[model samples]
Target: MSDWIDEIKSQLPAGRVLTDLADRSSYSFDASFGQYIPEAVVQAKDKEEVVHVLKVANRWKVPVYTRGQGTCLSGGPLPVHGGIVLDISQWPREIEVKADDLTVVVSPSVLTARIDEEAAKHGLMYPPDPSSAHVATIGGNLAENSGGPRGLKYGVTKDFVLGLEVVTPEGEVIRTGGGTIKNVTGIDMTKLLVGSEGTLGVITEATLKLVPKPPEVQTLMAVFDEVRLAGQAISKTLTSGVLPSKMEFMDKACIRAVESFYPSGLPTDAEAVVLVELDGHPEALEVEAKLVQDVMEDIGARETKIAQSKEEAQEMWHARKQVSPAIAQIKPTKVSEDATVPRSKIPEMIERLRGIKEKHNVEIVVFGHAGDGNLHPNVLCDQRDQEEMKRVEDAVEAIFEAAIELGGTLSGEHGIGTMKAPFMERELGKVGVSMLKRMKDAWDPNGIMNPGKIFPEEGQKLVLRDE
Candidate 1:
């Protein structure tokens, strides 16, 4: 470790490499509590420096992990192998908004919201607005193929990524896709690396597609007597041809949690709530808003309120954004799962999640992008309670199984990092899992780039064993 650290230090600037335990501990984990201290952390300033670090690590047979702001909830950035974490948040950010081309060229470390702000200057916008946009890097967003409230209408990060500059596992740089709108050039490597979660390559720069900013926007909140009614309302809204930019849901438990955090006049007695946002021309938005309201009322919504101003709309969104933190306040630890199903099956999936909570005797707060059928059922528990933690794990597995059975996926935006890699086989059949492993081997022949993640192991271990 000392020899490798010295070699890396000699290659880069004097202070770019860090081995201090305090700094190392800071890079150990992401937003999730999972932690694995790396032997060293290097904050790379340029693509050349990243190549230097990767080449040295490859030569020394040391594991290398790339990280952004460390805000990953799926543990994608966790340095589980404890070798080197190539912190990319320090990389230079440059956003070039080419209005004529309807695209933007941005550095990997650029914040998602900053791109939107910059695009807005040119009357344009990038629509994959993840909840963590304020802090998450564009590179991390592409790595996970992140989606958020707007995904129901504008789609996810993958839809907007037109091109990328990536560094392969062998420290070779390559460009995939470009500023052009359409490309049928080759194997579509850009899309493949977009959601590979750094196991395939490190994204240094990206070209993102942009759309015209909507002239008008409106938000509406509908309260339901039961959660199923809210789900039905969501189905009705989509079926009615009103493509809301944001369609979110929160159950009673989640609403109460948010109320406790910010008593913003949320209906405490309601069993469920749906927050919807429409963006387009004012005349069209008005028509769509009425259609949504009528559908919600027809679906048995107890009450509905439409935001009259942008400030009120922001306030409504603030309540939804407070969910994770609010649930965290209920317990020291939280296990958040992003299981998505068919839009029509959301109610049934929610019911199954309720059953899991009752069976395990644990509190589960549910909320997420209802229109897209992505639900985040967060199980709050104390990690110190061994027995309870075991039950939580079992409950999570049951939830994943239920989602799969309902034609859903184990994850919506969060990649299959170490946390979900064990269940990759359960989601993807044996042949499917093997195919993924073969692809990983082909890309990373030396098995050095973020190993033990996104692929099932050979011995068929159901869980990852610390090496």
Candidate 2:
């Protein structure tokens, strides 16, 4: 073992440091592609423990990868050049809600869903609802700037974060932002670190902003015969002055997959389904619901179903939630990409995705928070087949190109971990990426924090298959 590992063990409590191969192997892979076994895994339970691990790793110039629940779909926490995996998921969960101030201070280990659940008791709500809220930790969500259906109206994790207590790469503790809503005291370091994919620092605690729970929420499902029509309906409804709390899109492939997996009453015959949720005063939602319905019908929706009750609405959403798991049943491996475009270009983006699918001859399933133009286009394939995996990699690259061509980003919510590193320059260009690297260098001078991420290494390419 290295001297840094010994030093970390000396500082942290016994049994918190794992050097066994079995224990190390457990942290090798996350929900995303690639696997790398770290030399050691350190379970940090508090700020002091995180500080010690980072200090040792930084002193030795060893890479330190911060991780939460390992539910990252974009390889955010994977230890590519691993020395120590700082596992904060084991940290004691804390969710302290200050209802009067509409803010919640929480430990990084707290599950993202629990924050909202705690806030609900105070008649408040945490708006950033990532799909993995129940399984993923708040630290991971904050690191990746995760987004979900609610992101259309409420924004992503970064927007809700009012303050953060993060440990710098060299083990320096710093607090950015504060409990109040407005804080322009200095540089917006909170925003910079939130979506940094753990390249800059490790977050220990966070203060999240909450909002009063909506009085009423109405759900509507719009079924379209043509995929493009569904996209048009989403764009039209957003412009029609009825902004929904949640607007999700799922294509025929996703619908059929859900029905096959969970037997939801989704119309498998429809080419696409646009699920909309409007929340506000009951009276306003009633009018907004009608207006949205008219827009959907006018835009060529064959059938528009308004959720009659909360149960009905839950059922509709339950089906939408099943899209991911259901689609996974189609193939052994799923390459999920959140390639987002502008709202006006949604229809065209859908058309382009279709073209890419047909051109590449791959099974592509599309679904996501479409109201924000963030579409999750998944490519299903068997990784065992190298020939097919190569094609899948090519198809994924083409998908990134298509999104950038349409004035969109390579990633909407998922941060640029190893999966999207190679394409950073494609979207940001050389100069933009260089500026980001300069900022990163200024933050972590030794480059021991989450190495081999965000900024691409020389000659790096997206390789999903083994050598």
Candidate 3:
């Protein structure tokens, strides 16, 4: 391994290859759990550097885990197998907005939020707005196929992508899709690679599709004395011929957590609060906002507050975004899982989550884009206590079981990285697993691209021990 790593270092620029212990240690872990130090780290600033690094890795049959700004919550960038950490986050930032084409081309290192900001100047919008968009690089979002509140009406990252510039595991540069929005020339490799979790290839550049910005927007918040009623309000609004741009839910635990951290003036007494946003023509928004308000009131909402100004509306959404960081302050370790169920089964899922917290003696906070049934169930626990972590492990498994039992997936927006690999077979049968493996084998014949992710090894299990 050292001999091949030396060979890679010799070809790149002097500062590109990093082998010091301190540098290698920094590349060991990501936002997710578990840390395995790689033997080397290469900050590839361009596609040529990536090609050189991949060719050397393939020659040595060493795993190369590509990463961006390290904002992925699903362990997508963890170098568990220990080889090379290909960090492309330093690539030259580029976002060329083709206003006439209603499209944008960006480099892999550009932040996801910048795309939308650039589009907004042209009276256009990029639909996929992940919570981490402000800091997370677009490459990481592309790897995980991330979604956000807007996913309720618009689609996810995979839907807005039109083309990709990828480098195969064998160090071959290939183009999937093109600048055109409509392309059916061959198999849709762009979609295949977007959510493949970086096991298929390393994305160097991407061309994204954009839509016209909505003319008007309205915001409403419904305070629910019962959490079940909040879930009911989400489903009712979707079924009542009213499609909101964003519908978010936060439980009492999450509401108090945010208030304690940021003091957003949220109602700490309510069991849950649902924030809804409608975007369209001004006249249509006036009518739809009324319909959404009526639905929430009919479903037993205690109070419904409509924001009269844009600043107030932004404050509501900011509180919703603060749940993750605010809850992190409660414990030393936080296990965040996006176990999504059907919209109709959300109430049952919430009930099961509450029961699991009591059953395992763990503090779990719930919040997320409830309009799409994708809820974030975060189990807050200290990792130093081995016995408590054991209970937390069981609680996570039970939550996965509950989602699958409800005809939902183990992950809604997050990818099946190292955290959820062990449960792959439980959701997808043996045959389904095998078929996916065949595709992986075809692309990554050497199996050197992001090993130890998405596919479980022999007798693998979920263990959050700090050993």
Candidate 4:
């Protein structure tokens, strides 16, 4: 063991630092591709322990990859470099809701859904509810700036974050933003670190903004015989003055997979289905629901069904939540990519996805937050087949190109970890990426904070198959 490892163990509790291969191997990979073993794993429970671990790692010029629940779809917590895996998931969970101020102070280890559950006690709501909120930690959500179906109307995780208590890469403690809703004291460092994928600093604590719970919510499911018409209906409804709190889309492949996996009463025969949720006053929702129904029908929807009761509405959303696990059962390997385009270009983007699927001969199931144009086009294949995996890689690259070509982005909710790093320059341009690199270099001078992420290596390309 190195002096740094000894120092970390000495500083933290007796059982906090794990140098055994079994423990290290457990922290190797996350939800995304690739696996890398770290030399040591440190479970820091509090801010002081985090500071100590970072100080020792920084002094030793060792890479420190901070991780939460390891539920990141974009590979945010994968420790690609062999150094220290700073595991924060073991930290004690803390959630303090200030009802009067409409804010919540929480520890990094708190489950993302717990914040909203606590807020609900005070008739308040935390809007950024990611699908993995029940399993994911707030630290990981902040690191990746996660999004959910509600993101179409409420925005992503970054929008709800009012402040953060961060531990710098060099082990210095600094507070950015505050508990207040509006703070223009200086630079917006909170926004910078929120979506940075943990390259700049490690978040110890955070203050999140909360909103009042909606009085009523109505659910609507629109069936389409054609995929293009489904895309067109999404754009038309958003423009028709009825903004839904949640607008999700599912292709026939996803619908069938969900039905087969969990038996959600979804129409497998339809080409596509658009699920809509409108929230607000009951009277307004009643008016908005009708408007949305009319818009869907006018835009070529074959049928529109409105949930008659809250239980029915819950079932609809629950079925949508099951899309990920449902589709996973279709194939042994699922390559989930979130390539987002503009609302007006959604129809075209779907067309491009179809073309890419046919051209590459890959099985792709489309489903995601359609109102925001963040589509999750998943390619299902057997990774053991090298030839098919190669085709999947090419198909993934084509998806990225199509998004950028249509004035869209490489990722909307998922952060650009190693999986999408190679295509960063394509979306941000050379100069734009260079500016980001300069900022990253300044914040992490030793490059010890989560290296080999966001920025690609010289010849790195999208490789899913084992080399």
- Estimate TM-scores for all models: 0.96, 0.98, 0.98, 0.98
Tell me which residue pairs clash in candidate 2.
Answer: none
Give lDDT tens digits, candidate 2, residues 1-467. Answer: 78888899898876989999999999999988999999999999988888888888888999999999998887878889978898998899999999999999999999999999999999999999998899999999989999888999999999999999999998999999999999998889999888999999999999999999998999999999998888888888888877899889998899999999999799889999999999999999999999999999998999998989999999999999998889888999999899999988888888888888998889999998899999999999998989988988999999999999999999998878999999999999999999999999999999999999998999999998877
Off by over 4 Å in 4: none
Off by over 4 Å in 2: none
Whole-structure CA lDDT of model 1: 0.88
Root mean square deviation (Cα) for candidate 4: 1.0
Q: Model 3, range 1-467, lDDT digits (tens) per residue?
A: 48987789788886878888899999888888888898889998888888888998998899999989877788899999989999988899999999999999999999999999999999999999998899988898999999999999998999999999999999999999988989999889998999899999999999999999998899999999998898888898999999999999999999999999999999999999999999999899888999999999999999998888999999988888899889999998999899999999999999999999999999999998899999999999999999999999999999999999999999988888999999999999899998999999999999999999999999989978987
lDDT of candidates 1 onward, in order: 0.88, 0.92, 0.92, 0.92
State the lDDT of candidate 4 residue by residue for 1-467, as single tens digits. Answer: 89888999887877878989999999999988888999999999999998998899899999999999998877888888889998999999999999999999999999999999999999999999888899999999999999998999999999999999999999999999998998999889999999999999899999999999998899999999999999888988888877899999999999999999889788889999999999999999999999999999998999999999999989988888898889888898999899999988888898899999999999998998899999999999998999999999999999999999999999998889999999999999999999999999999999999999999889989889898
The positional error of residue 256 in candidate 3, measured at the CA in angstroms, is 1.9
Give the clashing pairs for model 3: none
Flag the better candidate by TM-score, 1 or 4. Answer: 4
Separate clash counts for every candidate:
0, 0, 0, 0
Q: TM-score: which is higher, 1 or 3? A: 3
Model 3 TM-score, all chains together: 0.98
Which regions of candidate 1 deviate over 4 angstroms? Answer: 458-467
Q: Tell me which residue pairs clash in candidate 1.
A: none
* lDDT value for model 2: 0.92
